[model samples]
Target: MVANGHHWDPKYPEYEGKFTGKFLHSHDFKGVTNEWKGKDILVIGAGNSACDVAVESARVANSVKLSMRSPQWFFPKFLFGMPSDVFAAKTPNWIPSIIKQFALS
Candidate 1:
């Protein structure tokens, strides 16, 4: 079966033969924390899904290893009564960060 992300990381192939633990998709995690829930999890990737999974998993898991090829950012799902994903992008760039940050606080 095809993987979740659009592009498969080539290095991940090595983990198929190396990693000896459960491999789960964040999309399927419906709050059913698994047996490995209490242990540290190495979440591979920095995309939205990876970040989301890491945050959720961190609640139950001791720690999370957010492996990222490069940096990533995630605005909140809601801000000012709108989805931050769209709002952050639409907000005028001229607005100072402190003002927005204060409003959010």
Candidate 2:
């Protein structure tokens, strides 16, 4: 069976009701536009989408802020010489699990 895990509904913060400024969901974000220029932006969450939004917003927005409930460790796109995901994909399955763990560490 195939399963699609995407969530359609956005989980907004409790304080969303009290805020009066412009608010948008990541699901609805198209790209940086003229309206976004010089506007202060606040991106919530620490997931891939949130990071992408914050990075893009910083380019055009006057200021960009990221808020996360907990700390998250971020890794560079490249590990050693190649892309981190590519490195993982190229690893031979025959390699011992312990060796793979050590190398990743």
Candidate 3:
């Protein structure tokens, strides 16, 4: 099994220097603050961290935009009243991927 920790360095986009607006990595994000209250924000990924940041920023930012290269499957925190992770953990591995996808849909 592959095991990776969460302390990896943030990867910057190639256009980092081209754009003049404020840019920051999700890894460096602390939380929403008054400084973000009226600024336009652009989040660059579709992962959990990006989603969290976008949601939080929307609460205070004048506008928040999420940009991703492609679409992704988004699962809610809860499924059938149980935590989604717990539900996935309890599912038998014998189930086929197609069936799982259908069920989730």
Candidate 4:
């Protein structure tokens, strides 16, 4: 295995190249122009990074779809002017899990 754990996703190796057209990773678009304008896009995950790509791609692509094997808990990019993850990290551990889930829901 790669030391960084950045190997290919094993879940769908066979499904790879089963489609035509551009297939890009989220990191490819960071700080770049929307070069895929007027194209159809299919983002293959729904994690925060993938969601960012889908949202950005949707602005120019003819159609955009996010593929996920399961639903995920989506969080806002910012809350009260702080990154959501930073805000979440400041949450007190003593708080009940139920309350946290409820508030996020």
Candidate 5:
């Protein structure tokens, strides 16, 4: 068993008492495979992680569906809620004055 991407050994005398459980992503769920290239698919778990996978799959697959346990709470990075993730990274100085004004105000 491994946790946090670290491999553990049961035989290690130093680790006489340690807890570990297998971690799984959406792909690990049964009946979900990479071969769904042109088939309708429903993916579960859509808080934040699942939405990403579902959107990508929809691009290639015939259709992609998501089954979420609860509503999602999402926030967009923006200047006054306008597109900004790309502009912020590429053009940092373009909005420096506005950012400073917003910060001060």
Candidate 6:
């Protein structure tokens, strides 16, 4: 990630019209203009990415609104039915790195 001139724009371009991972579902209008700092922010998506942006933007913005065009297939972020961040936190640090290497291999 490259944060140049107040924007953290990725230096890389998309690969063959595909994205490799989850990301914040947001608009560039607010980020480039800084008009979204204190206004009611509305995100128009329902994937996990959208969920993350909604949560993060609410922290700095006055309010948030999520506008979904269609229903998304939602899965609870969990481990054995409980939210997974807790377990992920407890996960051995080497495990994720190893898993990532294996996936790329």
Candidate 6 residue 44 Cα shift, in angstroms, is 0.8
Best by TM-score: 2
Model 6, span 1-105: residue lDDT tens: 111122344222233776453333243323423544676665655655556666767777788777665666554476655566675566677777877445333
Q: Write the per-residue lDDT of candidate 4 for residues 2-105, one digit (tens) a residue.
A: 01113244233335445655545554455325676787777777766667777777787788787777877777778768887887798799999898776665
Arrange candidates, best TM-score first: 2, 3, 1, 4, 5, 6
lDDT of 3 at 64: 85
TM-scores for every predicted model: 0.56, 0.66, 0.65, 0.55, 0.40, 0.39
Model 1, span 25-79: residue lDDT tens: 6545555356656887887777666767777777878777877667766566788
Residue range 24-83, candidate 3, lDDT tens digits: 777788889898999988788887788888888999899988778788877777777898
lDDT of each: 0.65, 0.75, 0.76, 0.63, 0.50, 0.52
Model 6 alpha-carbon drift over 4 Å, by segment: 1-35, 72-82, 85-105
**In each prediction, how many residue pairs overlap at the backbone (N, C-alpha, C within less than 3 A)?**
0, 0, 0, 0, 0, 0
Name the weakest run of 10 consecutive residues (lDDT summed) in model 6.
1-10
Candidate 3 deviant stretches above 4 angstroms:
1-7, 79-82, 85-105
Using TM-score as the measure, name the better of candidate 4 and candidate 5.
Answer: 4
Clashes counted in candidate 3 amount to: 0
Q: Runs in model 2 with CA error above 4 Å? A: 1-6, 78-82, 87-105
Task: Compute the lDDT of residue 32 as modeled in candidate 1.
Answer: 35
lDDT for position 22 in model 5: 29
Better of 1 and 5 by lDDT: 1
Candidate 5 lDDT tens digits, 1-105: 011111232121223565363233443334334665786656555544456566666766788767655676554546544565554555556566777555433
lDDT of 5: 0.50
